[model samples]
Target: MDTSAIEALPWCADLSLNSANIWTVQQGRCAIGVVLLVEKSASVALIRKARVEGYEFSDRLALPGGLVRGVCGPSFAPCFEQSIRARAEEEAGLTAEQLSELAIAAPEFAPVSRYTVKCVERFAAVFTVRANIKRPQKLISADKSIQEAFFSPLPPKWEELAPANRLILARAMRDHAGDNVKTAARASVNEALAFCNDAAATVNVPPVPDPWMSPEA
Candidate 1:
């Protein structure tokens, strides 16, 4: 992972409460979910690649996702739906139509740690699709950040993923297993959008400084 490149992205600005606390809040990255839309009968998207930096897990599996800007919008469903489609296409070479046919699976609020950063609170939206099309012959990281993409069975090995991603995958799997995939996915998306609208309504909310923490010390 290129720390500099990640930091330079425009979205990085939102990671911090203020400029002075960037590193401390790196884990507070952003929320973006990519559920591998799979047919009800088929339940996994598996891949192989090198773990983090030096470690290697030739047959590793994970859903596609990452931090996103413009996602905290008027509605979380559309934003999440759009982001998921975009990331899948961009990262795994999957298309939107290919995503919609399968059962939409998503993650409820869960905590995950990326690198040393911890997303203290997070949520995701998942969708499923069935494709007779062959999986990519060779997984290629479109963004260079991703290693590969493929499909496998659900309840993937949690210990295999980065801490943050592990939390996400675990929650998604748990939801899928609980028979709450559809309802939870919809609820999460709706809640996200509603939260966004409420927050937007308070755009003019007074910025009262905490007595212990001054804006200008």
Candidate 2:
């Protein structure tokens, strides 16, 4: 189907689609994971998307993210930063306008938040961005792939979360507890990436690039 986002990824050099409609990433792929937190909450009330039924990890609580494909431009545009920016908007309704810092969704911007996830066929580089939102429940979406979005309290019951989410979130809350939103978000995400190592292992991490690369691109 749409291959623009996959093409923009330098690492997906060996990407193909010979097996019907399924993509083949020989080297690996990039899965964009966003850690959406709300501002001034009593506790770590993290926002999680409830995946829609009939797909992998359906009905499970998870960070809003997906593969790099179809993110930058569902029709034509593509790029690294746009992919992340697009995912943040599409999944969490947090637009680049809302958080100007989110506009810089580039590689190497925060290497600490980057890591790899293993799969049977290949692996995925998990690219993450952490930000705080205002009243997450108000931003919940129903038209997207997810059934809905809601605030899942921090220290969420590990059993209720997606495996990768469990690993990442648990490690984040445990090792990076603090008050500063950005600092805490950074610590938790970076630390979790370092500790869990392969949170998306065995799970199909979707490629979530922006529908459009950018106004300039």
Candidate 3:
């Protein structure tokens, strides 16, 4: 199992959803997540998932997303920005116009980071987008399934997040840390990832399938 995180996944843009949330491409399940980070204060806008039964990452801090849902033809070229914008609007109380205004070009988002959570059998791609929000703390969840939406300090206590998200946040916050702190944080994340990979190797747990699907909101 390859535990190293990469900037892009081969199937990241190959997945898509119809209005009904079924996989339009039938390529299998993979999730895409966004890290809406406020640059000035080093905070990230995250939604707290509602305490729902049978839901992974229940009541945990996570990105604004569920399954990939959008209109796409056989080509399946819906960009990551589509889902990122959709989730930001639906769950984080942002409007399409607002998010659209934030984007200037193709790579409005930060580097992509792909990961897998062995315990949940989840494969996901998480992208970080820098934002400039004056009152980030006032943000609220627009979706009922989410408990609340607020700006969490980057690298928020890892215990408060789900497994894959822990690595995502770690990578995002590492950029804001001092050189010494950055090195330490990176080492910590690599060790954690190594541990997960070794455990998966022993258990023969399928790490990441050829394709991926569904994320949390």
Candidate 4:
């Protein structure tokens, strides 16, 4: 992950949906990916289980996000934000009202993919929210978009998160820190990179399959 890129996240420009501006490449091309940094009771929310097939990240633990398409069903907020919020709702079953209460931070970009991964220009944005949202139950009777939705404290256990999500999680925490957001951000960034390095140094082995999946509708 590029620390410089994380530090210089560009504020999402306000674009009107009425305009025919092409945010994504084309109708069936690469889709922009958006993620959220939702904090509840001093713990950050994390989701596991990717449904895509053959992708390196497929079926692995990851952040709550997906491809952004358009306005999330007639909301007054910017379409970009709505797309992210809708991804959260679709994947984690969060509500629009809950998303509205979130304080979104500047968005960060990354190369990402969807189920089939036809495009590689997917941009990932992180929204930071300091509120009281409960972790969804992890049973089949609960939310569908993820296998499990749980909260983890800061300095998160690096081994538990997917490679990509761990970096963004650190970036979001740093961006949302107190008056010393910069210092906090630097520390978190270092920790994230160090973990990445350590993981790379370790012995390679196939990851165990996780049972979490999108629940039946």
Candidate 5:
């Protein structure tokens, strides 16, 4: 991963990952989330999501994250950092300070814009933790948002994860290849490659033209 590239990114405050910033047809929206990768020994942590009443995909497995609301003055890097840290603590009982001790992956974004769908841009950061120095039991018990949480091998149990999480996890792992957690970095390469291959066959397409304002249109 290019640590320099991450460090040099131009922070944009307008970008967000808050669901509350729902975009209307006349405008676009931006939001952010984080993938909390907690590692110990050779295993990584995963939360078996609890079923939120009347919530869509509430039971789907996902990393610890939430909406990125509010601005962080001139730079949004602090917002991004704080958002993930807060979410990790809220949803998984992991502290931002603890996460800072681990390997952090470069931020990644996936923008989706289809005429038939909502136009929104979502950004995510990966906060990896090598918890050998921390008390795993205390951290685990403090997480109140999950139904069940457990540690699994690196590269994860692909079949056991939600489809979206599989890709997110793989991508974060790939970008964090140089993190302190060498096992996750090394194991994630193959998984990320495989996902990319499958994705290329389906999602690789030419850029969509702006139908509303185009010389050709």
Candidate 6:
């Protein structure tokens, strides 16, 4: 599969809900896309001091993505596998296709955790991509929430990323060093599937029915 195709997998984002000021365990699944675009002339595609309203990490440098919904929703509707690429195109103004024909360069997976008012869990996935794109441009912040986006060389303080995301990026870097896309993809798919399976198992809430009434009453 192409790099974009691989990145477009239906990765789920976890959200948390609460009741009575106590954190209740509830999960809300939302599809998200993350892009890894590398250009020879660019140092990195990392944006600094970006802003997204209602979120505290406004100035943090991170990958560009947004919540995916039906086309009628705020963001464009993306197919199951193309969601990542679609969001990349929409948010960062970048277009990506499968790089199968090109030499399999580098591939990696990163785990990102979600701890909002909706859910709490360590979400894991491999972040893989080809490293030979021509003249990749700075990501355009189509959404007003983002203040800026650009490329930069991987930072020395890479370990500072959210623990889950850091893990995936570290793995991707190692796989890239070894030029092991196949292995990385396999491992990522397994992990992603396991997460989905576990999440599905928790959604077993049965419907509540009205109280029964006795004819004697």
Best model per TM-score = 3
lDDT of all the models against the reference? 0.39, 0.43, 0.49, 0.45, 0.45, 0.38
Per-residue lDDT of candidate 1, residues 1-217 (tens digit): 1123323434333333223221222344333334443323344554434445433322345565544334435433344456555666766677655444333322222232212224234332212222333433433456555667765545455445433334344444542354454333444433333443333223321121111222356
Greater TM-score among 3 and 6 belongs to: 3
What is the lDDT, from 0 to 100, of the residue 131 in candidate 3?
46
How far does residue 4 in candidate 2 sit from its true spot (Å)? 22
As for lDDT, the candidate ahead, 2 or 4, is 4
Clashing pairs in 2: 66-206, 66-208, 67-206, 67-207, 67-208, 68-207, 71-209, 71-210, 72-209, 72-210
Please write out the lDDT profile of model 4 over residues 41-98, one tens digit for every residue: 5666667674665554555656666544455443323555665566666666666655
Q: Give the better candidate number (1 or 6) by TM-score.
A: 6
The better-scoring model by lDDT among 4 and 5 is: 4
Candidate 2, residues 21-69, lDDT tens digits: the string is: 2233433343333343333353433334445434445566666655445
Q: Against the hidden true structure, what lDDT does model 5 obtain? A: 0.45
lDDT of 3 by residue, 140-201 (tens): 66788889987777556556665445555555554345666555455545544554444334
Tens digit per residue, CA lDDT, model 6, 1-217: 3444333433322222222211112243322324444444424454443544544345555554433233332222233225445555555566665212222223323233343433444222323333444554556757555566666565313422333333334443442333353343444434433443343344421111111112244
Using all chains and alpha carbons, the TM-scores for the candidates as numbered come to: 0.44, 0.50, 0.60, 0.52, 0.54, 0.47
Residue 28 in model 1: shift from native, Å?
7.6
- The candidate scoring highest on lDDT is 3
Q: Residue 98 CA error for candidate 6 (Å)?
A: 12
Clashing pairs in 3: 29-212, 29-213, 30-212, 30-213
Task: Please list the Cα RMSD from the true structure of every candidate, rounded to 1 decimal place.
Answer: 13.8, 10.1, 8.8, 12.0, 10.2, 14.8
Task: State the lDDT of candidate 5 residue by residue for 1-217, as single tens digits.
Answer: 1223333434322333343542111112222334566667656667766766644335666666554444454344565456556666766667645554543443323211111113332322222322223655444524555776666767576555543355555554543444454444344434443443343223331121211122344
Residue ranges of candidate 1 with Cα displaced over 4 Å: 1-43, 47-61, 71-76, 101-107, 116-141, 167-217
